[model samples]
Target: MLKLDAYPQGFEEDDRLRSAFTRNLTLHFSDRPAPPSVDGAIRSAGVPKTLIRYWHDPHDVPDDVRACLASWDRLHNEGFEFRTFNDASATAYIAERYGAQQLKAFARCRHPAMRSDYLRLCFVLAEGGFYVDADDVLLGDGWRTIFLNGTLKLQPLCYDIFSSGMVPAAEIWRHDLPTEGRIFYVNNDPIAAPAGHPVLRRALGRATEKLLGNDPRPEIQATTGPGNLTAALVAHARDLAFAGAPFDFELLHDWDAIAETRWDLTYRGDARNWRNMDALGI
Candidate 1:
């Protein structure tokens, strides 16, 4: 069944964002109580459907996140689900995708590095398959169009500067970066993949090789953060001169496009909302 997993932790800030999202979703879509396969999961978990699932590692689940979940449960009638993977190693897709050597490169590093691990975990779930970031909100309630298509999808790593957290340092920062580098991630907001695509596999393989390499100047600082990942993708595309791939989907970057386009919906709220929120100085 199609399963949506939240990062093991770090939803405290996201909860409010999601609350806004949930409100908007209900207001906009309201097609069904839940997306396909989601209702059953909620019922099986025996939680209120309104609650947002906290799928991060136990330690990763922040207090604010817990509060958000609780609030979501109480406020919304719909139920939600929470899950975890006891075995990190088991989340691997490519046999050698994320080895010990590669993990240490960023494991126990900074939040950015940690965020990279989360992203890697998502890719792990995807196995180069397909997954979406917490944001990447939908518009006009056409989620089923992509979800039902039975294809794997992922947002590109590039496009926006803020969401580029998953970017490898070597690719972007050039010099060695501190934990602050994590902030520069490539947002995987609305990633997707076709049933059978080799790009995902290749991307994982490349990430694995880059991470496992022991050079002090590891290619891209052993990061596959969203921005770096997206940069790497474009770099690869330019190198191979390949085109017309599933990864070539749309990205909601520009303010104009984000505001004007009908498909401009995102987890961060609509462009006008973002602008207004920023203006409110909150």
Candidate 2:
């Protein structure tokens, strides 16, 4: 079992706690040979080469969210095509490809997390671009440079244990321990892929299956979130090897590179919320 001391001064100030957290979080591809250099990867992937974001309104954007938007705008100014889809447009796109029924079901999704999760997959699969969460700020021009220059990068959600302090270490270990003894969980927040990439296709299939089941209270992680994405990736890698296609994955950066804005002020009461609730042991 994992034993965690009470972080009296909070995790940010405690180096030991931070180190332990990082150590427990394993990257699956760390052992494999690194993928091709970023430039080579991007060249191979080809393009519409765009950036996509979904928002209800650009006019009423929040300050923190604006920061993220500005970063993307900077990328666009520098030459990348950036696209924003409001709710209506997003729904219409989903309807065209999946059906009106699927669109209605997606509309009824109460959780912002769930909605964005599904939309990002649909958008990326259809358009073949990068999807960055509205709240995730790009560190610098390097974010665009690295992505355009390199291959597809998967920033799978690190398991939530570091902040939640709820699941026991052994229990988490038993369920999440990678078969290779180490693997990273794919995150939905910043996913990029080529149009018709097999991995994204598989994830869309799995997500659609989950949605059709009408599983009341679909766990965010397992249904439209990282857990499902990770499973799809694992399947993709295995299938690719069998089919003789080379698959190599790499980390985007060290944990500290990207800055995440706190969400406590924005989503305080939502029980299903995941991001930025560190003080609540989430």
Candidate 3:
């Protein structure tokens, strides 16, 4: 079992129990092959599979963000492709393809951060490629290699405990937890998927529903952020499992060696960052 100083109120104890349940259920099915949809996606991969970035405008992009883009561009030239979609291009693309409803949701988003979440999901589902937030920098050739080899995999959908800090501890404890804290929440900053992957499609739908709803809360994480993405992933895993395939989702924990080298530039002073650091006992 994992140990922590305090679970910020009510996170870890329930997570501990859920983790136990999932393990017991799946212990005998560990070595099964991935589902057919996953296998088919791997085989039908297309390229130059894009590396997508969304920003307000090319001129407005920060220097740090530009540097990160450059890093990917350099690796991209070796054997991949990259594209940037500013507001205008992104807006038009959504309007043309996904229709006025999605386009309106994209525009109606009060926060720029929320707009970005919708844009990334739409672009990836439509064009089928990798998406990386401008704020994150690639560590090395691992990402490129994974794409080139068509071995890119989805991290298991898990809630980010750090994002749950604002929730009353009692509420968190009472909520049905998914997995034990053993899995890391898949960070949305870097993602790769073939065009029309079911996971991305489902996420796009969920995000659109939340955005178009009457909810007044402005929290992007719950509406269209990593938490939203993680939920879609969990659904996708369940679908696969129901079809008698193993839960073959590749998790970030499995890629620690490569992930350790990558960095989230925005994490430095955020309270959530400190919480995560504490959770990891770093």
Candidate 4:
């Protein structure tokens, strides 16, 4: 079941986001069938085909964003799960004050982003096991793009200059932050690591210690927390490269550039090997 939480009401803001998510979900999940796999036999198969369908309408997205969203959505539904853990206690307060449904009951709130819960929401989802963005639409037929390929994939943050397209744990620890400041790397958008990988464990450990609890140090609060942590992962990957490890540094760097170039919807042009992948029916 889709579990939503409660938040303070700003009628205009809540209404707008609710409409957007409804429209986006409708578009994203509409007419989609389960893949021919074990998951098809699971509960996911029973989700309403028309739960969201607007995404099928290409007219709503510009040409550039179409491919990215399509690919993202496909991955999200096929392999990844999505969720959030938010201020249940605070929500309980709202319910009691306003004579609404009980705290334990689920109610749709505005998209967590509008409620200042975007980062934590994504992090909790990641911790709970999901790897895609809230609005990323998936393209293509399978999720192999994120897995079979040696290079990890993520939407790079243009907000930082030293970011990678995909930050693995190897690269994160190497980020050169100022002496007095802390660095964080964010892979909150869509990050691919082997499920149950050690790097993910370490990243989660750091996130749990830093983000979830009361261990908020001054440096941690001042720096870009999650994004910086993701950057640290990329830096860690660089260390592996230095150690003569078997990794495609060149490919990783290329992906970093691609993410920076807004590769989500904007194709990386006709010259790259993605063109080759396309030509091969990939």
lDDT of 1 by residue, 1-282 (tens): 101133112221242322222222222222223334322122221111111121334455444434433432322332223222322432342235455644554443233333333444344334332233222222332332333333333322212235653453123323232333233323443444442244344445455555556543332333444433443433333333234333332222221211112333332242223223334442
Per-residue lDDT over 85-114 for candidate 2, one digit per residue giving the tens place of the 0 to 100 score: 766677778988777656865775556567
**TM-score, predicted candidate 3 vs. hidden true structure:** 0.66
Instruction: Pick the TM-score winner.
Output: 2
Clashes of each: 48, 9, 1, 50
Which parts of model 2 have CA positions greater than 4 angstroms off? Answer: 1-28, 31-47, 57-60, 145-151, 160-183, 248-250, 254-282
Highest lDDT, which number?
2
- The local lDDT score (0 to 100) that residue 4 gets in candidate 2 is 31
Q: Which portions of model 1 miss their true places by more than 4 Å?
A: 1-56, 67-142, 148-152, 156-186, 194-196, 215-222, 235-282
lDDT digits (tens) for residues 1-282 of candidate 3: 112222223231243533333232233223434333222122334523677877766666656556766766665455456778877888888988898779877876655567778898898778777776665566644553334333225433334455653332222223244443443334565667667767778888888888888875545765677767766665565455556675433443223322332354553344223235334443
On lDDT, the stronger of 1 and 2 is: 2
> How would the candidate models be sorted by lDDT, starting from the highest?
2, 3, 1, 4
By summed lDDT, the worst window of 10 consecutive residues in model 2 runs over: 1-10
True-structure lDDT of candidate 2: 0.57
